[model samples]
Target: MKNWNQQEVEILKSKGGVIALANPYDNLVTTGVEPWPPAEVVQKLYQSRQTRAFSEEEKEKLQKFNGYYSDFQSIHSEDAITWSVFGTIARAQIEKRNKFISELFQTLDLESEAVESSEIYLWRRIPHPDNLVPSGPEIDFGILTNDTLVLGEAKWKSSLGAAQGKNKDKNQIQLRVEFLQKYAPKLYPGVHNFVVLSVGLNNDVTENYTGKTVKCISTTWGAICCLQSHPHHDELQRYLAWKIKNTKNG
Candidate 1:
């Protein structure tokens, strides 16, 4: 039997979709749009990275492909889903965006009010607060408001990654909570609302980690699709449903 990634690629191809290529990366072929919805936002954030760290290999890979940050064509791309769901919401019209965010917080059972403005950062690198480790975890996506910060870790066909090098004591979510408590204050002072959202196939993603002050919650891609019921999200919803069905069959 073919593995999950193979199956996903085949499914996309069968539906007239194409895998993204390094040379002249085309978002139209990969994600059904010439310019991704979050293109401008991503470019702005990437350009503002003064202290962001990337390994030599990572830098080389990024230089080879402009689409490496989004990577929507990859079969197992969590970034793709993150961009589709949260990014879409962030870029939506003010009323619609506020509604979507309110729904999201409601889904997670967190008390929140819609904000006039917010920022969504994809793959944000937060350095270690006290040099406890060489580097800190790169958050999958973070939604920042005037009074709240929602840090998310999205997974597709995978579990939460193991602890960083030589740091087996804390899992991925724990590390993010550590950043929220220890490091995030410096960046967004007086922000009391700290939430760690785990987006994955199931609620089990939240079973491994707990935070003292940060509230942690898990929701599946399907749930997000349901909440974000816009025409733009139809393709993603269908794709995730297919993956879930196939995964269950296997």
Candidate 2:
């Protein structure tokens, strides 16, 4: 029997937990898949049905058929681990920026609301999107909505190294367009934007990104921005405005 003690619990877990084993569907990891481009990830999954850890019978099933797909496995998938690390750190930085920006703006007593609703996911690791959803490979960060879809990639570094491995050739960033084309077609139903934020620049890389209708942008916080949890907004004009003491200084 499939352990009726936790049948209900296992059933619920079984619904989707399989990916956790095969793909580690860690949603919030919530950031980069590899030093290389996430689009490079390509493989077929192989396994017998039934979750709750591989059982003897399930192992037998895998060996019984033993077809090409049977042995199919991801020996080297995209660095889902790195992506997860990047996402978690980057989102935290975003929150920090939001706070700093909000605190700075609040002092002026401005009347504007910044929505704090956005999800970051460790997306690129999946062989395919969860439950065969119509999502795409704009991984690292690809969130979609009614009007606009934001495809974000977060790059991180310690800045302690003499050299860093960034897509200096602009290869991965360039492939992002293709990543969109292949992974999540639905996100591109209409308009979209591409964002690449790096902690530091690679040793010999140039910043050359392209797309016809895509709006591509980078951050002002320099490449070392990763080391700082919170970043000052790069608008020197705005920073200068804040520099002069306001009538109210807390």
Candidate 3:
């Protein structure tokens, strides 16, 4: 049987009084997963394009919008990394809370790949000055098969606030909502019906503060309340207590 130790580790990180990660599979490259489709492919595709075919005037017009294509090209080919702890520590928090994303992917029949990398930050568009390209996202989770596409955002934060240093406190939930509405039906011609995950929390995450303002999408900034009621609460509690005992003995 596959050890659920790593699974439990993610749970512990989100819980109070539970510290230190459990190495379940003994895998290196902890907390980061690189996505498939290497970057070289993207570079080659960009080179093969016949830029000469377009007039200089047309090229200028396109260059103005190069930010969109540049990012698309880079993401398509770059190695994607998702922080295992930051992305989705408690899969149940997402899968169990939102039946729509769970069923949505099931319908698409795409096997979800769990990546251990920081690239998930990209997918989540964790609020950052440099990451304004994607902004927040209307939808953060998705299933992409050979041809089909289904996308949605999952919200599991404790509360809302001014994440970007702005005095205006924006509900973190709304960031994902606007993302899909802004990009959907336009970025990809075939993609339709975007979805967002609306999570609720009964705890105050802002009680703890850092020097700088943090964005809501940053999984690290997610509220503990989001993880408290999660189905795996008992399992996590058990695992951490056991780990603490073993550590003291050693």
Candidate 4:
């Protein structure tokens, strides 16, 4: 495996950008926030994880500078993209936030009813209904309202992961849907929405995951970047635009 720091440095170079340092802690090159978002906002998002226990993998990842939670230098990181986009939304003024959410729902063909009141949580671990795994899928982010839950899986240069160990037949989406159907309601008590947010996706995902009980909607990071206009969005938009361009050219 490539050193995570080197991977990010290469991605930045590929975009015709340069970095003074290759380290995540020093570079803070993310989807493009400099030195990260406001300390309070980042702290609140981090604190949300305290609501539940983390798996050993999650705990270890949290400790590493290049791991998802601490990573801000990687342009190819899904967590970096997720935090930059939604973290900005989390701190936006209510009107602008709601407007952005409304436009996002319309773009994804989802109902707009919950846009105004939803709460956003990042990297939340939902327990498996079957107890077959040590921990269930750690959702990239979740938008929750009184009657609706939107679980998002984000990608930049990667594809959705496959099931490991004993559950080889199911893909990550299937596992997430299983949680959405079997366990989500007991915790959130709402209509479920499973969204695959990516630059582009394989057809197999849509063909295999969409069903009556759970709807798997596919949308791109570029589409999301287009949904809002805010000063805070400038860096993230520029970063995602480069990613989308590169993804298409290849």
Q: Which candidate number maximizes TM-score? A: 1
Top-lDDT structure, candidate number: 1
Candidate 1 structure quality by residue, lDDT tens digits, 87-123: 6565556666666666677777877656666676677
Model 1, clash count? Answer: 0
Tens digit per residue, CA lDDT, model 4, 1-250: 1222334332223222322123443323243334555563354334223212345544454435433432344334456566667766766667766677667677767764656476666777777645746587776777665555677777655666776324477666777777767766566655555443333333232334556656777676656666655435566566565544443323
| Candidate 2 residue lDDT tens string, 1-250 | 0211112111111222222222223111222223432332222233424333445444333343333112122111223323333333334555663454344224323333562533444444322222333442335545433333445454322222222113233344454544444454464464343333322223322155555544445442232222333332232223222212111222
In model 4, how large is the Cα lDDT of residue 231? 35
Model 1 quality (TM-score)? 0.67
Candidates arranged by lDDT, highest first: 1, 4, 2, 3
Clash counts for the predictions, in order: 0, 12, 18, 0
What's the CA error at residue 78 for candidate 4, in Å? 1.9
Give candidate 3's TM-score.
Answer: 0.32
Each candidate: what lDDT?
Answer: 0.60, 0.34, 0.31, 0.54
lDDT over C-alpha atoms for residue 158 of model 2: 23
Order the numbered candidates by TM-score, best leading: 1, 4, 3, 2
**TM-score on alpha carbons, each prediction:** 0.67, 0.32, 0.32, 0.65
Q: In candidate 4, how many Å is residue 187 off? A: 2.6
